[model samples]
Target: MNTILNFMKRNYKILVAILCLSVVFFAFNSNAKKDNDPERDKLLLELLTFVIEKGHYSPAAIDDAFSKGVYKDYIQALDPSKRFFLQSDIDEFSKYETRLDDDLLSKDLTFFNLTYDRLMLRMAEGKKVYKAILSKPFDYSIDENFNTDYDKAPYTATAAELKDRWRKQIKLSTLSSLTDRLKIQETKAKGTEETSEVKSDSLEMDLLDKAKSDKGVENSAPKTFEELEKETRVSAEKSLDEYFGFMNDLDKNDWFSVYINSITSRFDPHTNYFAPEEKERFDVSISGKLEGIGARLQKKNDYTEISDLISGGPAWRGKQLESGDLIMKVAQGNGEPVDVVGMRLDDVVKKIKGPKGSEVRLTVKKVDGTIKIISIIRDIVEIEETYAKSSVVEKNGFKYGVIYLPKFYIDFDDKGGRDAGKDIALEVERLKAANVDGIVLDVRDDGGGSLSTVVDIAGLFIQEGPIVQIKSAGRKKEVLYDRDKKIEWKGPLVIMVNSFSASASEILAAAIQDYKRGIIIGSKQTYGKGTVQNVIDLNQFVRNSAMGDMGALKTTTQKFYRINGGSTQLEGVRSDVVMPDRYAYLKMGERDVENAMPWDKIDAADYTIWNDNAKFKQAIANSKMRISQNDQFKLIEDNAKWIDSRSEDNTYSLNIDKFKTAQSSIEEKAKKYKPIYEYKNSLKFNSLPNEIDALNKDAILKEKRERWHESLAKDIYVEEALNVLDDLQSKAVTTKAMPVKIKKGKLAKS
Candidate 1:
């Protein structure tokens, strides 16, 4: 009876396993059938639309108005310069401008198909028009003007009008070349006159006789106006050919990306759709590393041209590839070479990027027009060129460390990869070992990265406190705190920001300012980008749908606020010591972006103010006084005004003589600002002692460090920042400590 019981139990277990397998098999079959269904794209579209509507933080209602917005944005994106799609084409597309919402509901793409087909037709016509216009030399003597600001321009009404537009556009481009050539010739003539011996009257005749005896002129004649014009026309033709070739490489997926992004953009500028390949590119950019040939490729006249070789990458190490070399074909490990000419750049990049240690051979056309085949073994290229680096600057007998963090970079999937917080901590430790009096954290042009990393970095400068406040739609506000009680550096600290410093950069700068831990300096304000985004994998949303890799949707799911209850959306963090710079009057911040979220305030988080000294106001006043007296800064302010004036003048003269006169006038006026570029401070900058040996070992790295040091020696901003640091240090020695005050749950000064 016991043996009979054991047999029954074993059979029952087998039966359960069989049932489970059957269920999985049925589910797999169902998914497979769905994948083969013709309505897969429609289902995927529905899923995407639903996700955006349900998941976006500030989702816009998809009605007739929203559809109209999508239509206008999409059409503008396709032809932003107004170079394609005539009035007739726009009229044809306008018919469905209000019907897009209905089509989205039904999962139909009639509007997209119609607009895409018309764009293709117009693009084909544009290719021929530009080529025909560039085939012959342009008459630059015509007194015509081309307004570069496309918004004020109107669409062409007929083919003849479009052709005339193309002619003017091509003429404007050719005029630039003509002006450049003329300048070069004038420069050469000036050099010749400066070096040449005085020609005697008899010597001139003797030279002519000698030339006749030799049957040729001794020196090559300078290029004439007509010859220069022909050369300019040739160059313009080649450039246009490359431009049209790149346009031809745009496939359905490319146009679809633009279309889908237009839809996502209605929510916010930060929200975007990243196709599979685009996602990979985004990862590479953030991590600053990729496993590939390590060359930047660009489309040029039916060829994939190498634009740049990444320092220390496989191609750069190989020493055979170079910028301007055209990649004609690619082969894998002695396999048959596949012609990549006329292929899309992304597709060619895929063929070249492979697993590390794999061999790829490329047939390349060198810049000098020589063709050669070269093999390269792919490797992981680390773009350490833009990573955070620190240097010591000696000013007023005190050494100040300057840490330039280009971005807050982090690899999400690689646990062992580089982290900005950890790297910055290590840099701080190095600076401390050097016994620097103060530190200047430069986040100029840093577009920001990983939020967690910013919080970690901000924690280094202060004791435990709330770093930032995050609030999502329909969710409670959460305060991110630095739980750690240890401080990394307690010396005088200053953060330098600019209009390009954004997101994570603003977070650290704002937190440091709020806690009174450091003084902020540089531009009038930082880039206002307080939104948080997350890239969602679309495949995870579909259970049984057969759409292959529907890409990821980067949606802004939350908004961040300063610890002091202020949002950095439109009103970014204002610098305590504002300085005039090139972007001072430029519209280049979050306010410049379309569909940007409005700024608002939230409840301030609890925090403690640093109470080291109470001379912050005096320090800022001293800095301002110095800036007002400094001639370099005065020049900078004037230069900023000049740049703003130039940016406002968009109209250009097509006449060659007038164009040259304008160019010459600008160059002459710019001569006064030459001193700005030539100014050199007395400060001496050096790498940390521990890093000197490693830098010397790497030639490329050594050159980069040398260039960086040279730039620092000439940077007026760094000079001023060091002065501020010195002032802060001087005041700390004499000023008494003040009691920490809290106002409305925020750090306040008494």
Candidate 2:
């Protein structure tokens, strides 16, 4: 004991010496940074110049990168109208140029707080400028007023400008003018006599004639503002009014600004920004009930168009609201009507979204050139609210287990029994206990839910392995391994998906494909949204700053990927067999969106492959042949063709005379198919008009779910998957089934 104590005392001195050296190093590193390190400050100043002077973006973008300890702002800053930022301000702002070496390394909250306060002031100023622009004049004119060399994002075209004219401003006339009279000016020392001012009247006219042809064969004539103004002013005024309301409303009404400000306060795009009211509205949107007229609205150009109407909702119940109506104005239950034309989309949404049981009148413009007022009494849209469903399908004379994963969803707002993953798992177990031949996990149209639950749900399929990889700014890689090795169902498995199968759904589908554990069947590709987002609360990033006093927002912080390098982008997982459905006509996918993060690859990690790699190609071939001959597929194809034809056109015009004939021609074709299911509308479960009365939420909640057991006979995708499973079950199957991969040539030609 004495010897050990002596040894410890001797080593303690060494430890103390090491600790003292570290402290000295840290202290010197923090304070010894040359206050006038022009090299560091020079780069900072240059970055500031590049961002403010050359970039077309928001100052918040610069601040976003700055907060993340990014010494360099790669993305430049632009005004709200997207005019290039002033370089002088960036150069002058060097007073706050910080090294961020030791303080950030030590995770000092003070450092973060100081940065936050500085950025908040900058961001506040940026917002102030934007507000002024929106308020001072409701400018939506682009031709004379819109600057051409700015960031031309759809939402960022805030200047009063002619719609979409910025796209044409890249011509040589706008960029530079060509002229030749160089030799006219000569030095005093050497005055050359080689140049004549011009030849004669004939020669000048000839030159001018050639010059007219030089402009281009297809010459474009710029619009005369006085001539165009008569028609454009109405639109311009409406746009100005809308933006004016939004800018004024933003002080307290539009919390979205606060949320975005809060998120960018912390880091570049890592944090989240959500308006306070929007957050509440988000809950109601997924919960399937809200006030105002029930309709899914989206901004298209300068108009707010109806996207979808929830069946049985107030809008649908009113029966006058159509899918493509333009909401020109909205009046609060008999109040003074306000024009909504050329308005910011969110502002329109704010006016449209309200509490249930309220009255909201829409001055809507129908597809047929007519305007009318539609009054709707809001109610809790029950069908839109619940995810309750039950399906019965029979396969191969024997009953196959039918399980539906309605969504990768969980009501985080609710406390007990709020787990969607667990609910799906329970359903699967119930189906398996029925002694069924096969199991189907229907993931069609599921956007996503909790990531933690996704990992848990993945464990229910293949034996333990890494399910996903999460990467952040610091290159921190979190491998979410499925340690739970419990196999839920060993029977033949099928996963049904569609174009809407997204994040969590893709993870499951990818896992199932990776392990050769199940057959994937659905649309040509899923939504391909495999990336993840992190919601950073604004107040947390700002430290002691009073940022907490602001509202919250969630930003798209980081992206997620599979254990393998490739992320799902334009192409989602190819299903084992494609299925024909109504949504096939819908032109929706991640590829259709702008400014979406692209698909990329990273370093590959080790993964264990299972032994089920036989005959997948042959299975795919067989399924394709059968689908080609199917009647349902032909109908779906025809509809998709019509839908595609409409989407390809940039402009649409309706001939009211021929329009009636065209509308009826299409409706007659749709009447060939009878309704698949009758609508059940009632408050009480028993009173609900339907054969699926026993399959109500109350019955499922009470654990009386055994009342129904169905098969997978009718579903095209499920049937194909079963056929593939049967082929796999066969020992006769030898070579790989013909790969069910998408041929770009086929898609391109189509």
Candidate 3:
């Protein structure tokens, strides 16, 4: 389910492009094939390949080289951990390594079929091996280690070797569970006067014997190693069961998606293919509103389990549906109940979600082992919970505003729909009414949304200017501009971004930096996704086709550049005040993505730099000095370095005693970093007076605001941003206002 969701998220721009592009009708074969048929898949492949070749901005040639790339990606996608397939399987599949392009061109599935069949066989073998390994108790006293870095590990060469690998994997999983349980027990036993004096070797035997007894075991003694082992085995079994169940649920379309993505991704990372169901999921994510029981569902051991309940949603209001509850069956109003056990999570969701005000019944098994039928009236679950929101932060008698934009979200189909720009403008107005001294625009972890919305938001800062330059293959560069001359906020501005901030986020930040409108702060660079994608409906491309709702194809149509000529492609927007972040040393950008478009530049768009640019140099210097002297900043740097070092150490001891000792040592070391979490800014944040009435009326809104304020008080990044804003504000007040001038040459420096 997570894999499918990730596929939708990465391919979201395709749905956006689908709405933006005018649907052009083309001739299609009337008698192609029915849905779910192999012929339909072949037709889909042909259509997808044709679309990529003709529509993609930088389509790779369909040659042996491309085929090899696809083959490697496809294999990796199939078994990324290199656990399911063996070296021999890879060797066998290598015959079609450079022949995939030929097969795709001919719409042949011979390679796909062979690989699929092999995967099924390997998975069955894996299930047997895991079950056989877990059937008996594991000896945690063995001195062995397991390397979790699967990329560096070689595939097993024999069945015995594969079983051994599975055994070690199972042991590692079980050891983690055992250690966690032991810690919990130790914590619980801390205040107790009586303590068990059971030896490590005899603990399992005693626990096994106690298990054979009655209720006296719980009250008479603490749990032994045998009980913990039993519990861990049960959990491991359930996990494996759920995994294989999910794997079994994958139809040809699922596998086809993997293959199609491999091909599309060769052109660029953003280009993708979305099945019809996947497109719906993308819409739900973007719209942030769905008519349903708003409970996050996950597949757990052949049952649809409620993982989380959205705050203020229907499920939350019901109070009966809780996390970890297993959904047994789903039924419509006054209808016969349909068992949902073993059903696909998407199918279960479809059964549960209905029109607003509609009733859906769910027979759920609670985590406490009680079963009940709970009926919930479905309402519009406002994913407004995921939208842009703001809070007023007060520091040193100055009230500053922090607006966190999760994405540049917009419903392209609905002009009057919720927009990030409008929401942000409203937030700015609310902050202005409260008389904020400055504002921090937080775009951290925002992967970006609508391009038009980003332009509108950028316009709110600057009076009027070109925001970004876009260029398609063999086409003249088109510069997107802020036509509106009205400035929404003239006070000091700070835009906060991180490694996850990409595309539209980069555009907004770059435009602000290019014009010296605001100080961009955070990690060294953003996600650096500069390309634009357009999702074209395959059905529209092939008119009157019997293939039945051919999924959309998202193709990279253009590449966007900052107004200052530099493309935010592999090289994302650089921050003015660089700070050490967890991802600072991590390879997590467009450059890290496979086949990401190379960075380049074009002529700078005609724009004038803000007259306040002179203040940035000194302000940046002051910020650097403060960060260098601050204890919190020092702790953050140390923590980031420690995390990076830990990330490099993938090998883990399998022995229970050694594993526990290692975990304890790490925990002891982690205690020193606890000060990082305890570090709190002196800033006091609050909701605007105008919003107080609304917030008071809406309990969920009030709760969200309180949570946001609490988080802001602890956020070191926002504190630093506020400090930057302070310096900018003070500089503005001390220095004389410079006359606005239009510079014709190079862009301003940060």
Q: All models: lDDT?
A: 0.80, 0.50, 0.81
Distance from true position, residue 11, model 1, in Å? 44
Give a tens-digit lDDT track for model 3, residues 1-750. Answer: 000111124234654365335334223457765544777777678777767776677888889999999998999899987778989998999999999989988888988888888888889988998888889999999899999998889989988888898899889988887776676567547866322321132333344444546555543456788978887787778778878888888877788788888888898888888887787777676667678988888887688889888877899888888898999989998899999998888788889989999999999999889999999999988786668888887787788999999877776667888878899999998889888999999999888777888888999998898988888787788877799999999888999999989888999999999888999999999988888876566775554556687778778877888887899998899999988785577677889877888999988877877776666888899998998898888888888888888988999999988998888889778878888878787778887787788787767678888888999999998999998887876632556455454344443433
Listed in order, each prediction's TM-score against the native is 0.88, 0.49, 0.89
Cα displacement (angstroms), candidate 2, residue 339, comes to: 26
* Model 1 / residue 82 / CA error / Å: 1.3
lDDT of 2 at 347: 70
Judged by TM-score, which candidate is best? Answer: 3
Residue 489, model 1, lDDT: 94
What is the TM-score of candidate 2? 0.49
For TM-score, candidate 2 versus 3, the one ahead is: 3
Q: List clash counts for every candidate, in order.
A: 0, 37, 0
How much does candidate 1 score in TM-score? 0.88
Candidate 1 lDDT tens digits, 32-120: 43222335556545656766665567888789998898899999999998888899889888998898888888878788778888899
RMSD of each: 9.7, 19.8, 5.5
Which residue pairs in candidate 3 collide? none
